[model samples]
Target: MTLKHTILLFTILIALPMVSQDTSSSVSFWNILKSHCGKAYEGSLALPEEDESFGGKKLVMHVRACSENEIKIPFYVGDDKSRTWILTMNDGILTLKHDHRHEDGTEDDINFYGGTASNAGKKEIQFFPADVRTQQMIPDAATNVWWITLDDKTFTYNLKRLGTERIFKVVMDLTKPIALPEAPWGWVD
Candidate 1:
């Protein structure tokens, strides 16, 4: 065979194994948030309190990233109709803002930070929200927080259900990438 053909054959053989592995399923929190369009997700963050059931109150997420530098995650929970929140998770931390008007489209609950994943093996992550504020909790005393994770085929988010006497936590699991989103401002849309 020609010398060039021999060299090309050897190069292809060496790269075969590496090319076969589909490891790109692993995505970062920043890209995940910035990829949202007009999709609305219906899920609940199950509160861990004995007094409150998993679906007690309501936990739903609305996503939007209309501006160039933003990827917004808006969260709502429970019956007392506690303040809504817009969240951004990236750089290993979660930033949160409170939205009290519920109609005026304002952003509040503002806090930015970095936190480590306590339950890494369980495909779970917990991030710091703010200081001296009341968040959701379980009767067993687990602080409800923003949790993120990615598995072989899906991405998941868990938000704690914040309340006064009820103090509980809730979880939501999303199974579709097209449904979950990849950009906060939704570059593709």
Candidate 2:
């Protein structure tokens, strides 16, 4: 083989492993989320001193639906059943979206606001910065960064608005799965 061909082949071989590693981590993270597919976990607000909506309310997250490339989780706050989190995986990339609906099962005006993972995160955590759609729909949240951490005992969802004091976090105990709540609004099954 020519010297140039040898160098090219060496470069390709070196890069292949990195890509595979990334894919592995991403898939591992997906599987971790999938593992709780049929369970419901109770959570509590863990950040910010006070919030009108979430504070003093019973928080629950139901990993209600799962598919080969998608998972749907309904997040309930007390009596409100309007929020569902949808995670989708495509080509080893994960996208997070918030699906909000009204009591009548209609999509909210500011729905589906979330972001895609910037890189292959670890098996236990992933970060998603605000995407263009999120920015355009909610200008105040343009600098938002959302992340989730999961383990055998706990799962936490977190959010931070860069350059601001706005932050939110909810911690769920995975060791105790609660009874599944009713389906969120707009969920067909």
Candidate 3:
């Protein structure tokens, strides 16, 4: 082969792996969730106090819709199927948003409230502080910070409102794959 062609081929070979390599820990975290696509898990609140909205209810999370840049997981609290967690990767940054809907599939006024990762967190965890939009939507939640931890055994979703007593935590067992739940409200499939 010609020297020019050989040099070009060598360059492509050297850059191929780098192109496919994870750009950041956020991507690694995304890959971890993507791996669990189409699966569902059961969870329970870890906080000592029982929450009225979540207490005494069967908690289930279905990792339903997944794509190259987004994953939508429907969170079922007993018969209430009004919440879904939407995670999207944009320009190497991961953003988490909550989609709340009514029984008729209508968007809730307090929907899409979440934040983007402040930095590239660890492969197993990422933290999202309340964004400007979230602050505007829920002034009381301005100090809110949400995070998720995913590993082989457990996946936990947590929230803590800074300078307040409000906190929510739910831990799902990853090892036990439960039966898939129906799609959340406002979800087509």
- In terms of TM-score, which candidate is strongest? 2
Each model's lDDT comes to 0.42, 0.92, 0.91
Cα error, candidate 1, residue 39 (Å): 1.6
Each model's TM-score?
0.43, 0.88, 0.87
**Model 2 Cα lDDT, one tens digit per residue, 1-189:** 999999999999887855343577779889988999999999899997599989999999999999999999999999999999899998888899999999989999999999999888888898999999999999999999999998889889999999999999999999999888998988776
Q: In candidate 1, what are the lDDT values of residues 83-130, reduced to their tens digit?
A: 434444333344444444323333334323222332212313334433
For model 3, what is the C-alpha lDDT against the true structure?
Answer: 0.91
In candidate 3, stretches whose alpha carbon ends up further than 4 angstroms from where it belongs are 1-23
The positional error of residue 94 in candidate 3, measured at the CA in angstroms, is 0.5
Q: How many pairs in model 2 have backbone atoms within 3 A of each other, for residues 3 or more apart or on separate chains, i.e. clashes?
A: 0
By TM-score, rank the candidates, best first: 2, 3, 1
Summarize candidate 3's per-residue lDDT along 1-189 as a digit string, tens digits. Answer: 999999999998987865443447988888998999999999998874668988888999999999999999999999999999999998888999999999999999999999999777889999999999999999999999999999999999999999999899999999999988877887776
* Residue 101 in candidate 1, Cα distance off native in Å: 2.2
Better of 1 and 3 by TM-score: 3
